[model samples]
Target: QAGTALLLLVAVVVAALPAPSLGWGVDGHLIICQIAQGRLSDAAAKAVNELLPSGAGGNLSSLCSWADRVRFRYHWSAPLHFIDVPDNVCSYSYDRDCKDEEGVKGRCVAGAINNYTSQLLTYGSSSLSPSSKSSDNLTEALLFLSHFMGDIHQPLHCGFASDRGGNTIDVHWYRRKTVLHHVWDVSIIQTAEKDYYDEGAGEFVDALNKNITGAWSDKVQEWEECAKNQTACPDKYGSESITAACDSAYKGVTEDSTLSDEYFGSRLPVVNLRLAQGGVRLAATLNRIFGQSKA
Candidate 1:
C-alpha cells in the first residue's frame, strides 16, 4: 500500500508536469555519452563505473537510451523548482520584490546547488551504513545530479521567480493549453527533433562541446543579468510578456512559421551551449564525488 500510494503520487506529478518530449527523448544517454568520451579522468571513470555493471556492453547510442530512462524517472521534473511552494499569486509571480518572500530562493542556480548539496549529503550518510547502501539510491542521486546540472543551464529553468517559472502564465502550444515554461521545456525541443543529432554519442558530444565552450559563461551572465535588472527584463512581468518571449525564443525552432527560421537559427547555438555545459559539468561533479581526476 505504501508503494502504491507513492506510485500514484509520482503519476500525478508527471501528469501535471508532463515530461518534455524534447529531441533527445532521453537525457541519460547524453550524460553517459559524455562520460564514455574518455574525456573524464580515471577517477571519474571509476566513480561512474562503480554505479554501473562491470561489463555492460553497448556503444554510445544504446548506452544513451538506457541513461535517459534512468535520468528521466529520477529527475524529469526536478528542473521545475528547487523549493516547492504553496499555490498562490507569489507561486506564479515573477515580481522582483518577491525575492525577499519567505520560501523564495533567488533563482534556479542557487536552487540547483542547494538541491545537489542536499542529495549528496543524504547519499553520503546512507552509504556509511552497510544496511543502508542501496544501488538504486546512488544511481538515482547521480542521475538527478546529472539532470539538474543540465536544468540550471537552461535559461527558462532559471525562470522568472514571480510566475512560478511561467506555470501560471497559460498559453497555447498548437491549440493545447500550456504554460510558457512548458513550451520551453518540451515544445521547442520537440520542434527540433527533425534536425536532432542522432548519430554516434561521440559525434553528439563533439557537437555539444563546440557549443558549450562558447555559451557557458554567456548563460551564467544571462542569469546574473536577469537577477540584477529584474524590471527591465522583458519576461520578468506579466503573462503576455512571458508568452511573447517564449514564443520568440522557440518560434521558428518549434513551429512551421516565418518566425521559425530566425528563431530556430538563433537559439540553436544556445541549446548546444547548454548541452555541452551539462555534459562537462556532469563529468566534473562525478570526478569530485568519486575522487576521479579531471578528464
Candidate 2:
C-alpha cells in the first residue's frame, strides 16, 4: 500500500539519524519528575526550589534530563549513569557489583545516588556558608538525582555484562533497526502510547499525570522504607532492575528482531510500574532529605 511505503521511508530516514543519548527517553524522564513534584512535601518542595535554577521556574521536573544534556561536558559522569551486572546474578552488592569502564568500583547509579545524597546533606547544612561553588554543587547534585532516579528504574540500565545493557544484542522496533536497550529506552513507551506520540510534549506529560493506573500506590510506602535504609544501598534498585531485565527486557528478541504484540502488551505494564516506582521513590527521597524530619 502507499501508506505502508511512506511509513517505511519515514522509518528508514529516522533510523539513519544519530541515536539519542539513552536515558528513559525525554518523555519518560519528564513523566517521572512531574509525578514526583506533585507528591513533594512542603519542606522538600522549598528545599528543592532553593537548589534549582531560577530559569527553571523553581520546577524540578523541568530539569529532569539535565544530566544527559551535560553528559558530554561532564564526560567522567557518563559511567555513573548505569550499572553492568552479569546475567542471572540477580543481586547487587556495592562491594562486588559496582563498576564502570575504568574499572572503578562503586561508580554506578547507586553510588551516584549515595554520593549526591551525601553532598546534598553536607552542602544543605546551615553551618556551611553559602558560596557560588557550593550552590552550583548542590544544583548539580539535584540534577543528578532527578536524572539518575529515572535511570536506575530502567531495567536495561541494570542489564547484563555480555550485552552491554542490551546494546550489543541487535534488535528492531516496528521494522526499524535498534538494539534491545534502545527498544526499552525509546520504542516501548512510544509503541505502547502511540496515540500520544504525535501529541505535544506538555500534552503527553499532562496525560501521564492524569492517568493514575498502576501498582505504585500500594508499594510507595514499602519502596520508600527500603530506600530510607542505609544498608540496603544498591540492592534497593539495581538488583531489582537486573532481575527484571533477565525476566522481561529480553523477551522479544529473535533473528529478525520483530517484536510481536504480545511483547509490547506484556512490557507495557512493566514500563508503567517502573515509572511509577521511580516517581514515588524520587519524591520519597526528597521528602526524607528535606521534609520536616529525617529518616
Candidate 3:
C-alpha cells in the first residue's frame, strides 16, 4: 500500500511541472522557411546553397531550428530567442524590451535579429567586419535569421512579461494539461487532422508552399520596408503579436482554461498570418543581403 501511495504521489508531482519550449515548433519553423525559400531571388538561392549542406539540396527549412538544437552548447543564446513586453505595452523597443535574463539590455529576440543581420552583411561587403569569430560562419547568421523571424511573429514570444511569454499560464489542450506557450508552439498546427495536412513537418511545409498563392506575396515590400528601418522592425512585429496575444490568444478563458474550437478559430488565423509574414520578411532580408549586387 505504501509503494502504491508513493507512486500516486510521484505522478501528481510530475503532472504539475512546467515544460518550456522555444520558437515555433519544428513544423511551424519549417513551413516558414519553406515559404521563404520559394520566394528567394536566384542569387540568394546560390548563397543559401553555399551555406547549407548540399546533401539537403539547398533547403533553408533544413536549418530552420538550428538555433534551438544547439542552445545548451550556446547557453548565452537562449535569451536571444524571445522578448517580453510589459503587461499592457505591445510595442518592442530595444532599450525597453530587449533585456536578457541577467537584466542586461539589448539581448532579446529583436536585438538578436539586428546583431545577426549585421553578421550576414559581412558576407556581402568587403569593408564590413564579421560580428564575432563565433558568428564568422555566414551559415550561423542565416540560421539565426531564419529562426528569429519565426520567433518574432509568435504572439506569445512577444507576449506578457509576467508569464515569461506564456510559459506560466496553465491551459488544457483538449484533455492534456499544458502551458499556453506550448499551445501556440505546437498544438495549433499539430492538432489539425491529417486529412487537411500531412503530419510530417517537411511534407506539411511543402503543402503550404504549393497551396500558397501570390495573395500575400506583394505584402513583402511593406514588411521589408518596415523591417529595414531599425526603429520600426521589432516594434511593429512584436507589438502586433502581443496585441493579438491580449486580444485573441489569451482573451477568452475561465478558470478551466480549456482550448476548444472557439479558441482555435480565432488564434489560428493569427498564427497563419505570422507564418506568412515571417517567410516574406525572411526572403526580403536574404534578397537584400545576397542578391546579384552582393554576389
Quote each prediction's TM-score: 0.52, 0.83, 0.83
Count of steric clashes across candidates, in order:
15, 0, 0
* Deviation in Å, model 2, residue 45 alpha carbon: 0.4
Q: Please report how far candidate 3 places residue 162 from its true position, in Å.
A: 1.6
Candidate 3 TM-score, C-alpha based: 0.83
TM-score, cand. 1 vs. native: 0.52
**lDDT measured at residue 204 in model 3 versus the true structure, 0 to 100:** 60
Model 3 steric clash pairs: none
Per-residue lDDT of candidate 2, residues 1-295 (tens digit): 9999999999899778766545788878887898889888988888888889999998888899889887767888988888887665766677776778777887888898878876676545544444534443788998998789889999988977777788787766767887788788878877756654464446655555555434234555676665445522445788788878878987546545777577888887788778877887888877767753333
Error of 3 at 215 (Å): 4.1
* Superposed Cα deviation of residue 17, candidate 2 (Å): 6.7
* Model 3 residue 117 lDDT score: 74
Give the CA lDDT, 0 to 100, for residue 279 in model 3: 82
User: Candidate 3 on 1-295: residue-level lDDT in tens?
Assistant: 9999999998889667543478888888988898899888988888788878666777889889888888867988898888888876766666777897679987888888877777776665544544433437778888998899889889889877888888888899888898888888889888752435656666665545544555555565676665344422655777778777888777875335989778877777777777877887788777877763373
